[model samples]
Target: MSEPMLDDDALLRYSRQILLKQIDIEGQLRLSRSRVLIVGLGGLGSPVALYLAAAGVGELHLADFDTVDLSNLQRQVMHDSASIGVSKVDSAITRLAALNPQVQLVAHHQALDSDSLAAAVAAVDLVLDCSDNFSTREAVNAACVAARKPLVSGAAIRLEGQLSVFDPRNPDSPCYHCLYGHGSEAELTCSEAGVVGPLVGLVGSLQALEALKLLAGFGEPLVGRLLLIDALGSRFRELRVKRDPACGVCGHAQ
Candidate 1:
C-alpha cells in the first residue's frame, strides 16, 4: 500500500514526534496508517487508547463489555463523572474523538468469545490485551498467536505494574500462556487489591510506547522482555522472557 500523505496540519500536529531522529516523516506516516485493537476500556485501556489516538493511529477497535462506574474515574481517565453508567466504549469514543478527530474509532460493546476474538485479532494489525483477567489474557494471546499479530499486554495492581509484548510472528517471543500457564490461580482485580491511579497510567503509557515502536519500526520493542514497575519505590526492572517450547498455547505440539 502506498503511504498516505500527511498534510500541513498533520505535520504540524505531529511535529514534536516527527522531529525525533528515530521517527521522521516515514515513521510518522507509518503510525498514521496502522490499525490497532484494544480490548477492555478500564484503567490501562484508557491511556493506551488516548495515546494511540493522540499519536495518530489510523484506526482503533475499542472493545469493552462493561459500563463506566463512578469508581472508574479514579484511574480510567478516558471517562468522567458525567459518563458514569454509560458503556465504556461509547464514553471512550467521545474522548478519543475529541482528542484526535482524524483517527477512526470503532466500538465493540460486547465481550468477545473465542471465535469473535480470533476474528477481531485477524482484522487488526496489532492487538492490545488491556483486559483485567487471566481468562481474557489467555484468550487474547491465543487469538494473537493464531493470527500471528503482535500483542502488547499490560497490568497494574496495588502499587506495581507489568508490561510485555508477544509477537507470534517471532519464534523467540514468549506468549502470555508461556509465562503464566493455564493454572487456575485466583485473579486479582483493582477493586479487590486496591490499585494506585498513576500505576495504571505508567504501565498503559509503556504499552502505547511499545505499540508505536512496533508499528513505526523504530527503537527496540519489548518483544522478549517483561518490564516490571514498582510505583511505590519509583523503580523499574526488566527480565528476559523465553519462549516455552512445551507450552500448550503456542507450542509446536499444539
Candidate 2:
C-alpha cells in the first residue's frame, strides 16, 4: 500500500517535530497514521490523551466508564467545571477535538468486557493502560496480549507513580500480569490514599511519550523496564522486569 502524504497544513502543524533529525517527515507521517486506545479518563488518561492528540495520532479510542466530578479538575486536566456530571469519554473528546481536529476520536463510554476489549485492541496499533485499578489493567493487558499489540501502562497513587510497556509480539517482554499477579485486590486509590496532583501528570506524560515512540518507530521504548517516580523525594528509579514463564496471562504454560 502506498503511504499517505501529509498535506501543507499537517506539515506546518507538525513542523517542529519534523525538524528533529530522529523524527523528520517520516516519523511525523508515521505518527499521523497510527491509532491508539486509552483505557481511562482520569488523571493519567488526561495527559495521555492530550499529548497523543496534540502529537497528531490519526485515531484515538478513548474508553472510560465514569462521570467527571469537580474533584477531577485537580489533576484530570482534560475536564473542567463545566464537564462535571458529564461522561469522561465525552469530556475528553471535547478537549481532544479542540486540541487537534485532524485527529479522529472514538469514545467508548462504558466499561468493556472481554469481547469488546479484544475487538478494540485488534483495531488499534497500540493500547495505553491508564486505568486506575489492577482488574482493569489485567483485563487490558490480556486484550493486548491476545491481539499481540504493544501496551503502555501507567499508574499514580499518593506520591508515587510507575510506568511500563509490554509488547506481546516480543517473547522476552514481561506483561503487567508478570509483574503484578491476577486477583490481587490491594485497592490503593488516590482518593483514599491521597495522591499529589502532579504525580499523575508526570506518569501520564511518560506513557504518551512511550506510545509515540512505539508508533513512530523512533527511540528504544520501555519494554522490559519499569520506571518508578517518587514525587515527595523527587527521585526516579528503574527496574528490570522479565517475562514470568509461569505467568497465567502470557506465559507459555498458559
Candidate 1 achieves a global lDDT of 0.92
Q: 56-175 in candidate 2: lDDT tens per residue?
A: 999999999999998889999999999999999999999999989999999898899999999999999999999888789989998888889999999999899999999998989999
Instruction: For model 1, name the residue pairs that clash.
Output: none
Task: Quote the positional error of residue 128 for candidate 1 in Å.
Answer: 0.8
List TM-scores for all candidates, in order: 0.97, 0.97
Give the runs in model 2 whose Cα sits over 4 Å from its true position.
none
lDDT of 2 at 53: 95
Determine which window of 10 residues in candidate 1 has minimal summed lDDT.
Answer: 182-191
Instruction: Indicate the residue-level lDDT of 184 in model 1.
Output: 33
lDDT of each: 0.92, 0.92
